[model samples]
Target: MSYADVNGLSMYYREHGDAPVTEDNPALVLLHGGLSGSDDFAALVPELSAHRRVITADLQGHSHTADVDRPIRVETIGDDVAALIKHLELGKADVMGYSFGGGAALRCAIQHPDAVRKLIVVSFPFRQDGFFEDVRAQQRQMSPESAAFMKQTPAWELYERTAPRPEDFPQLVGKMGEWLQQPFDYSEEIRGLQVPTQLIFADADMYSMQHICDFWALLGGGQRDAGWDGAARPGAHQLAVLPDTTHYAISSSPALAGTAERFLR
Candidate 1:
C-alpha cells in the first residue's frame, strides 16, 4: 500500500519482488484498465516481479487513490504517471498497460519518451470510430441496479460482462460512458515512437481487435499475421496475438504472463 504525491493528488501503488535500483535491473510499471485499479495485475505482478521490479498503481479516481475534482482524461492520467516516475527518480522504465490504461501508457510514452524504456499495450484502442460509439450507446441504457453494481465491482468482476452477475452494471456503465466521452487519439503519436514497443491483443477482446490491427498496419510494416507471429517492425515495434483469451486475460489467465515475459525478455 505505497503512496506517492503527484500534482497535488495522492496515488496509491504497490511493488512486488526484488530488483536492484540500478539500471541493470529495470522496472516495469503496470497500469490497469478503466474502472479497475492496480488489483487487476495481482496475479501477473508476482510472476513478473521475479526478474524485474514491478510497480502497480491505482490511478487517480480509482481504488484507494483519491478521486480527482473533475473527470479524468487519458493525457492527464499520463501526466500523473510521468510525475510519479520523476518523484521516484526513475530515469526510464518499461511500461505495460491494459485496456484503457493501455491508452494512458501510450500517451505517457509518446509525451515523455525519455522516461519510457519500452512499451507494451494490451487490448488498447487506437481509434475513435463506430465501435466505441456502440459501446457508449449500450452503456447509456443501463438500469439503476446495474449501475450500482458497477461502481463497487471487484477488480476481477470488472473484466467480463457475463460473469454471472448483474450487481456492478451501473458502475461499469458509468465508467464506459466516461471512457466514451474522453477517448484518446494516439494514432499519430504511436507511429512516431522511438522506443521499442509490443502490442498485444486477445483474440476475443470485445473492443479493440480491429482497432489494434489497424494500428499495427499504421506502424509501417509488412502484412499482418493471423495470430502470434511476433511480426517485426521498422523501429523495434512488435505485434503479437494471444489465442483463446478475452479482454481480461491478463488477470484471468496465467498464460498471458508467460507471453508477456517472453516478449519483454
Candidate 2:
C-alpha cells in the first residue's frame, strides 16, 4: 500500500502490474463502490493488470482512506482523484469505477477533461433521478440503523477490518443518505465530451432501459439508422447492457472485465 497527500487527503492506493508508463498506455485507476474498499475490484484488477498497470484506491470515508470534514459529493471526490493522479507525476490514466465510485469517475471526466484518456463507468448515471423509484425510496431509509443492519455483511466486515475509522461507518452511511437525497444532471456535459467513453450497466440494474437509452442519446447513440458500412452507426461513445446480471451481482459478472477490456482497447 502507498499513500499520497492530495488536497489534504492521505489517499491510499495500490498499484498492480509491471507495465511501463507510456503515452499510448497510461495506468488505470480503479475506484470502489460505496461502503466498499479497493478490495472490491480484486477479481477484476488481475484481469486488467496483466497487460497494464492498474491502480486501485479506497475513496474518502470508505476503507483505508479516512474522511475529511467535507461532504461526500461526486464532484469533490473526483477532484481528489485528479489531485492524486497528478501527485503521482502522471498526466492522466484511464479510469474505471463501480457504483458510487462510478459517479465520481463521471465527474472526473466532466471536471478534468485534460487528465483522461478513456473513461468507463459501471452501473452509474449522471443524476439521482435516473435511479428506480424503489431504489430512491430505499436510499431514503439509510441511516445509522441501516448501517447496523449491514454490519454483518461482507462489505461491512471488510470495512471493520481495514477502514481508517471503523466507528465512523454509521456516519458515512448518513452522509451518503444526505448526498443521494439531492439530484443532479450531467447530460449536457456528456454530450460535449470528446474523449471516447463507455457506459456499462446490468440488464437488471437500478436504471430503467428507457433511462439508459436517454443517457445514451446524449452521447450521440441510438440516433439513426446505419448505412451498413459501419460509417453512420453512431458516435464513438459505446454502451453495454450485460445479460443475466443485477445491480447487486453486476460487479461479479464474468462478462464485465472482458467487455470493459474491449472498450478500453
Candidate 3:
C-alpha cells in the first residue's frame, strides 16, 4: 500500500519479494489490463517475485488511482510508468504488462528506454489494426451506457470494491472507448528498439496469428533460423504463445510466470 506522486498522478504501487538488483536480476514491474487494477495480478506477482522484487501499480483512472483531467491514452500511461520508476529510484527495471498495460509497457520502453532494462508485452499488439475487426467494433461500442452491463463483470466488482470514486466507473469507460477509437502504429519504433523484449500471447488471443507474427518480426524474431550453436539468431527478443489459454486468461496462466522467468533470467 504505497503511492508515488509522479507525473501529476498519485500512482498506487506495491512491491513484493526481494532480491538485490543487478543487470541480470533487475526489479520487475507488473501492469494489469484495461478496466483492471493491480489486484488482478495479485496471484501472479508472487511467482514472478521469487527471484527479484515485483512492483505492481494501478494506472491512472483505474482501481485505487483516481482519474485525472487528462484522457487515458497509452502514451500518457507510459509516461506515468516511467515517472513512477524514477520516483521509486529504481534506475531501471524489467517491465512486464498484460493487455492494456502491455501497450503502455511497450510505449514506456519506446519513449523512455533508459528507464527499462527488459520488456515483456503480453496479450497486446504494437498496432491498432492488429486487433480483429470485430474486436475493434466491440471496443467502439463501449460507453458509459454499457456500465450497467459491465456491472455484472468481475472488473466492475473490483471497481466497486477499490475505486476511489465508484461513480466514476462510467466516465472511465467512456474515456477508454474514446481512446480505443484512436489509431496508432509503432512498428518502426519497435523495430528500432534497443531494449531486450519478449512478446507473449495466448493461443486464442484477440489478435490474429498473422498480426502477432508481424509484431514479432518487428522485434527481429521469426526471421532466420538459429545455427546448431544458436549463433545466427536475431537479437534477444523472444515470443511465446501459451497453450489452452485466451487473452482473458493468459495473464493468470501459470505458464505465463514460468515463461517470463526464463526470459527475465
Candidate 4:
C-alpha cells in the first residue's frame, strides 16, 4: 500500500506484481467503481498482474483517500489519476476503470492524452442520461440522510473498514448524489479522442442497450463490416458485453479480465 500526494489529496494506491513497463508492455492503472475502493478489483488483479504491474487506487472520498474541499466530479478525479501517473513517473500507462472509474478513465484520456497509451472503460455510460430512468431516480434521491440506509449495505461495510474518516460517509454520499444529478454529455469529446480504447459492459447493465450502442458508434464502431481479409476493419477500438453479468457484478467477472487482457495485448 502507498499514498501519492497529488491533486491536493493523499491518494491511496497499491501495486501488484512487477514487470518492465515498455512501449510494448505498459503498466496498467485501475480505477474502481463508485463507493468502492482499490480492493474492489480483487478478482481481476491477480490474473492481470501476472504478466505486468497492476496499479489500483482508491479515488477521492472513497476508502483511505480522504476527501478535500473539491466536489466529487469525474473530471477532477480523472485529473487526479493523471497527476498520480506523473507523480510516479510512469510514462504512457494503460488505464482501465469500472463504472464511476470508467468515467474518470475516459476523462483522463481526454484531458491528458499524453499520459495514456490505451484505455479500457467498463460498465459506464458516456452520458448522464444514458442510465435508465429508475437508476437516475435512485441517484437523485440519494443524500447525506441516505447514509442511514447505506449502513446495511456492503459499500458501507467497506467504507467503515477502510475510510480515514468513517463519519464522513454521509458527506461522501451527498457529494456523489450531487454529481450524479448533474447533467453531462461527452459525445463530442469521446468522438475526438485519439487514444486506442475498448468498451466493456455486462449483458444487462443499468444503462439502456441503445445508449451503449450509441457510445460504440461514437467510438467509430458498429457502423460497417470488416473485410474477410481483415483489411477493412473499423478504428482500433473494441466492445464486449459479458454474458451473465450485471452492472454491479461486471467488475468481478472473470470474463471482464479476459477480455481486457486480450485488448491490452
Candidate 5:
C-alpha cells in the first residue's frame, strides 16, 4: 500500500516479490483493467513475483487511486506509469496491462520506450476500430445512465468501498464512456516500437481473429510461419490467444499467467 507522487497525483501502487530489485531482475509492473483495481491482479501477482519483483498499481479513478482534473485517457495514464517507475528509482521494468490497462501499456511503450524493457498487452486492441462490431456498438451506446446497471457488479462495490469519493462512480463511468466513444489508431506507432513485446487475448476476445492477425502482422508476426528449424522467426514479439475464454475471463486465466511468465522471462 504505497503511493507515488506522479503526474500531479498520488498514484497507488503495491510492490511484491524479492526486495532490493536489481538490474538483473527488474520489476514487473502490473496494470488493471477499466473499473478494476490492483486487486484484480492479486491471484496472478504471486506467480509473477516468484520470478521477479511485481508492482501492481491502480489506474486513475480505480480503487485506491482517485481521479484528477484530467479526463480518463490511456495516453495520460501511461505517462503516469512511466512517472511512477522513475519515482520508484527503477531504471526500467517490464510492464503488463490488462484490457483498458492494455491500452495504457501500449501508450506507455510508445510514449516512453526508454523506460520500458519488455511489454505485455492482454485482451485489448491497438485501434478503437479493432474491437468487434458488437463491442463497438455497445461502447457507442454506453452512457452514465446505462452505467446504472453496473452498480450491482463487483466493480461498483470496489469503487464504492475504496474510491476517494465513492459517489463519483457515475462520474467516472461517464468519463470512461465518453473516452471510449472517440476513435483511435496506434498502428503506426506500435509498428515503430523497438521493445520486445507479447500479446495475449482470449480466443473469443472483443477483437476478431482477422483483427488479431492484422495486429500480429503489424508487429512483424504472421508474415510467415517459422520454418522447422525456426530460423525465419520475426521479431521477438509474440501473440497468444488463450483457449475457451472471453475478454472478461481472459485476465484471470491461469493460462494467461503462465504465458506471461514465459514471455517475461
Candidate 6:
C-alpha cells in the first residue's frame, strides 16, 4: 500500500511493474469499478503490467481510502486522479476504467486532458438521463431473497455465482449495497472529451447495449471538431461484444484482456 496526498485527500494505490522514467514507455492507470476497489483488477494487473506500468487505486470512500465529508462526485474523483498524476510527476498516461470507474476515467480525460493520453472504458453508462431511471427501477424490482443474496455473497462468489458458500454470501451483499449508493454522472461532461477513446461491452451485460452503441456513434461523430481518429477510422473506437460474458468481463474472460491490449495499443 502506497500513499499520495492529492488535493488534501490521502490516496492509496498499488503500483505494479517497473515504471520507466521515459516519456515513450508511459504508465497505465487502472481504475476499478464502483463497489469494487483496485482489487477488481487483481487478476488482470499481471497481464497489463507486463506491457506497461500499472497503477491501481481505491477511489475515495472505497476500500482502504478514507471518505470525504462532502458527497462524492465523478468529477471530484477525476480531480483526485489528476492531482495524483501531477504529484507523481507522471506527464501523461493511459487510463482503463471499468464500470463506474469508466465514467470517472472519461471525466478525467475531459477535465485534465493533458494527463490522460488514451482512454478505455468498459461497461460504462455515459448518458444517464433515462438510463439511471431504469437502473433505479431494476433495483426496486429485486426480490428480498435476491437482494439478500447479493448483500451477503462474497465478491468472488458474485463473480462466479454458482454453488456459493455461506461465508461468501455476506461480502457480495455488502458490495452490492455499497454500489447502490455510489455517485456517477457524466452526461454533460462526456461530450467535451477530446481524447482518443475505446468502449468495450459484454453481450450479456445488464446495461443497455443500444445506449453503448449510441455513445460510440456520438463520440465517433466528431463531438468536438478535434476529429478523433478512432471515431473516423474504420477500426477506430472498437466496440467488442464478448460472447457469453457478463458485466465483469475483464475478470470472467481472459480473451477480453487480449482484445483490450490490442485496442489499447
Tens digit of lDDT per residue, candidate 5, span 134-251?
Answer: 8888887667787688989999998988888887788788888899998899899988999999999899888899888888888989888699988777678988989999998887
- C-alpha root-mean-square deviation, each candidate: 5.3, 1.1, 1.0, 0.7, 1.1, 5.9
Question: Model 2, clash count?
Answer: 0
10 residues in a row with least lDDT, candidate 2: 226-235
Of the candidates shown, which would achieve the greatest lDDT relative to the real structure?
4
> Could you estimate the TM-score for every candidate?
0.83, 0.97, 0.98, 0.99, 0.97, 0.77
**Candidate number with greatest TM-score:** 4
Off by over 4 Å in 1: 130-134, 140-146, 149-152, 155-176, 223-232
> What RMSD value applies to candidate 5?
1.1
**Model 1 worst lDDT window (10 residues):** 159-168
Model 6 weakest lDDT span, ten residues long: 157-166
RMSD of 3: 1.0
- Return the TM-score for candidate 4, rounded to 2 decimals: 0.99
Q: How far off is residue 159 in model 4, in Å?
A: 0.5
> All models: lDDT?
0.72, 0.86, 0.92, 0.93, 0.88, 0.69
User: Candidate 2, 173: how far from true, in Å?
Assistant: 0.6
Model 1 lDDT per residue over 1-265, tens place: 6789998778888877777755756788999887677778877877899988888987756666656465567787888888888887877988888877887888889888888888888887777662556666765565435554554456436434322233433444455566666545667877778878888887776665567678876676446443466544345777777788787665547777887787777
> By TM-score, how accurate is candidate 5?
0.97
Q: Write the per-residue lDDT of candidate 6 for residues 47-119, one digit (tens) a residue.
A: 8888678888877656656555544566778888888888877789888888778877888898999998888
lDDT (0-100) at residue 99 of candidate 6? 79
lDDT of 2: 0.86
Question: What clash pairs does model 5 have?
Answer: none
Ranking by lDDT: 4, 3, 5, 2, 1, 6
lDDT winner between candidates 2 and 5: 5
Which scores higher on TM-score, 1 or 3? 3
**Which residue pairs of candidate 6 clash?**
150-173, 151-173, 151-174, 152-169, 152-170, 152-173, 153-169, 153-172, 154-168, 154-172
Candidate 2 structure quality by residue, lDDT tens digits, 1-265: 8988987888999989999867887989998888788887788888989898888988988899988888889899999888888887667789888999998888988899888889998998777789999999999998876888896798789889998789999988888888888778898888888878889999999998988899888888888876778787555678899999998777778899899899878
